[model samples]
Target: MLAAATALFALVASASAQALPSSAASPEQLALVDAQYNASGFPDSGAILTVSYASFVVQNGNAYTAEQVATAPTIYVTPSTTTRDEFNSSSVYTVMLADASSLGDPDTEGNYRRVLQRSTHYLVNGQTGTSTGSNYTFEPSGGT
Candidate 1:
């Protein structure tokens, strides 16, 4: 029950940070994330520019529930290179967040199909990069 918006805050927090140029995502990165989108009942936008993950940590609560995230929670943004040699630590990046209601349901014929509504939570531009490295902690307050 992970909150989809958690990634939005993480991007908002990471907008000022730098691109973490890790060993480019594996060859299966795009497929993996694409499959995720399909499974989540959302259409693929084909904009998997880079690899990113937002870790939301809430004290004494679960992210899946509304009561647990009454307010913004702590977010950690980690972005890495998507390809082998196309990432520039100084270039700008964009982040988008969308909400998916369910993991898809079966169709009338008993075949699984995506059948959930998708609403965009946020789309951020002017996302700059920070230092270059594999490990960098970016928080809304600032770098740590």
Candidate 2:
């Protein structure tokens, strides 16, 4: 009975190991992903952006799968027009997943979600005037 139990344990271990993904991204692949992300121009603002999280997904193709999370910087802008006091505010956070080639360029199959908020304030002659209310949009790619 002990021998049989040992054999069963070994079988379970082997099966578990086999069930894991063999094509997981390596450190080099992750570096490539970072480079691609930096060059993608997703953050076109002056605010500093940084990656908060990253991971890999296993798929049935030659492409490498990666997911990244990033944050946008708070922006404040004032218009020059003296007739009205105008200020703009905006912020965004994003999550993206992509299937990339060996060179780290995103392929056709990818998805991204961005949580964006923006507002414009206007004061005519320093008095309370018509102001654009804050707007929020949760944009996401159309895919499962």
Candidate 3:
């Protein structure tokens, strides 16, 4: 057990703190992700992700401020304004909402995990996506 723990520690110590995306993103996108990840404290995620999917943070009719989203009950992703026709209608997608500051906003387990200005982050899973013509509608795997 001691040897196994040592091996694990070595593996983690050698890994890059910067997230290396597994998905195919353009150079620009990859750069942006790296910058954001670095800026956000290079989270110690349970499982390192290879690709960060594009997700919209819309509250009103369009993009919203964190303050706006902090109070909103529902937030969903709409089709990308520039590329609406490139989506595959039959593809099922796994959408992850990570980096949501869960520190100092509201009470999450009495810890108050509502990030006001990029505090600690959290990874929200179980939300799956289904293509709806030119857009995708995401819902919890079991139901809405």
Candidate 4:
């Protein structure tokens, strides 16, 4: 009985850990990103948008050729406008550039993970206003 209880506890703990939420972009966030990208005049004619717990991406967009998706620089967005505290917190969304070459053995899923890792752009809500840079720019719609 003692051993069974211990095993059950361990299983529960592992399951709980696996079930913990990751800060990935939401549908609303994705739409905001798309709008901002369009507003910036950065064409994404062939890009594909995908979402996962790890990241959100505009894969194979006009930003990069199909073959170059592995090494292209990408924009990343936080699920919501980040506060100074949230930006400093560990639970902040993962937005960075991830290369397809660095993905995994199978490469497909790994490529997605890598893309999530390499997101360099962030999406700010209307409340936060707009921001711009040499490599990245975000202008929220509706004059916000």
Tens-place lDDT per residue, model 4, 42-84, is: 4322211221223223332224333433342222222233221
How far off is residue 57 in model 4, in Å? Answer: 7.0
In candidate 2 the C-alpha lDDT for residue 106 amounts to 50
lDDT of 4: 0.27
lDDT of each: 0.37, 0.21, 0.28, 0.27
- For candidate 2, lDDT tens digit of each residue in 18-130? 12222322344334334444654332122111111124222223232122212221111111122112222222222222222222245344421210111111111111112
- The model with the greatest TM-score is 1
- Ordering by TM-score: 1, 3, 4, 2
RMSD in angstroms, all models? 9.2, 21.6, 14.9, 19.1
The deviation in Å at residue 10 for candidate 4 is 24
Better of 2 and 4 by lDDT: 4
- Model 4, stretches more than 4 Å misplaced? 1-27, 30-66, 82-84, 88-144
Q: Which of the predicted structures, 1 or 2, would earn the higher lDDT when compared with the native?
A: 1
Clashes of each: 4, 0, 6, 9
In order of appearance, the predictions have TM-scores of 0.38, 0.17, 0.26, 0.20
